[model samples]
Target: MITAPGGRTLDLANLRCVFTLQGWTTSQWGSAVFKIYNLSDDTANAIQAGEFSSIQLIAGYQNNSGILFDGKIRYSSRSLENKTDQVVTIQAVDSHDAKVYATINQTLGKGYDAARVDAALMQTFEPYGVTRGRTAKMPGTKYPRSKAMFGRSTVYQDLLAKQCRFLWQFINGQYVSIFEDASLDDVIVLNGRTGLLGVPTQTIGGGAVIRCLINPTIQWRSLVQVELQSATTGYFIVNSINCQGDTMGDDWYMDLNCTAHNNLVDKPHKDSSKN
Candidate 1:
């Protein structure tokens, strides 16, 4: 679903979307590209004129569907494909992407602890539509003297995350901080019955790369349970996910790059199990 300016909503028929997610690296801000076909001239013009500000892509069954991508549109272009099909392409970044290059100049008085510093940071980002989400416990470090902060917000966030040994990123307009190996409590079981598409392969970094039917429940930092014959069966943390969907084509799927949650890598399971 794409929301143009003035609160007008649009439901496109011919659509293709790609949404990618990586860990807390500033360079890896969640991004999405949307291609819509045969849009009304007015709508296309609005999008091209920078009036379309946000988009929401949802997937899955009626009762199980959830938001797959919610982001801010950054650019849009209109083109004629084959001289008949009108195609409008929109490029967007995560809501927090603005903060990646946003400069901040602030000072914290002496005795400000990590929690206070985090609160200040959140306050700074509120104007950009960012809100606080789940965050890892920060170190109880307190400043002995006034702390002056300057330069890009991403830089300061990176420094803070490194000091706390946590990974920080914006997910769905909310700031999230979590340990590198930490997994969410809710586990999504994957198997033949649960939309696991093909055999999961091992990446060079000892992680697993999997393809499955579009599952909205799969997101960054999610815990996935793999039950398959050729892959190691255990819990894995979703480090990256690439979601692709086409309303008029056979292209709905998700590619996930996952790391073993506990480094559990026993021999491949010999029996086929249904979960």
Candidate 2:
């Protein structure tokens, strides 16, 4: 069992981090080496699977004490010689050392909404058959990239557009604020939905708030002549919406059911807009 460190308020429940064999891939007698590096720091410490690693983060408070990691076996090959490493990482805490009380899980505050977002991302990308590759953009990059696309389907663009949409809906009412009439880049207040307005109250040059439609419930197929941002084109489904904004940064996150569409359709007038 992992223990919380001193001066820390939270700890990673190692037991809770369950792992499963996702799948197996064989590359016709090719070698594959995989490693996990800390994206939060400059040091590219390789972490071993099923162990803890230290990851210093910015923006949120973190424990100076080390961290824990749980990873799967990495497979590597160089033509018939295949090898796998036990998951590994830079040690953050000692099991026998004094437990520090630091906020170990930076995203714990995001709660279930964060989980929902992760699920959406995984569902969208995993099916595309993308694989991780060594980074030329930055030396010693550990994460995977889309090394190949079966049909050149532009999956990355679609994923980004969908993510932006999700962010837009999530920031509504929960992060409330109005943008200026002229400025394209203004920090708007985000308040999770309160059901007052189903759309963005502000926009530039009388255009569609494409980001505003990212919520799970906003049916994208119903739009008609609504000018959209270049990076966005899709539909959304609202599986469930929970609104409970009573405190600062407190949100009422909704469970969503989303879909994407490539064609325009006739816009149905709402009951309130009746003359």
Query: Which prediction has the highest lDDT against the true structure?
Result: 1
Shift of residue 219 alpha carbon in model 1, Å:
1.5
lDDT of 1 at 136: 74
In model 2, what lDDT does residue 178 have? Answer: 15
For TM-score, the strongest prediction is 1
Q: Which ten residues in a row have the lowest lDDT in candidate 2?
A: 21-30
Residue range with the least summed lDDT across 10 consecutive positions in model 1: 266-275
Model 1: how far is 29 from its true place, Å?
Answer: 1.3
Model 1's TM-score against the true structure: 0.86
Error of 1 at 17 (Å): 6.4
Residues 1-275, candidate 1: write the lDDT tens digits: 77865788777634544344333333256878777888889888977887778887777776688877778888888888777888888887777554665667899899988777667777777778787877777667787998888887777777777776777777777777776556666778899899899888877777888889888888777778888866557767778787777776787788888776446443222211111
Query: Would you give me the overall lDDT of model 1?
Result: 0.72
Cα lDDT of candidate 2 equals 0.22
**Regions of model 1 farther than 4 Å from truth:** 13-27, 230-232, 262-275
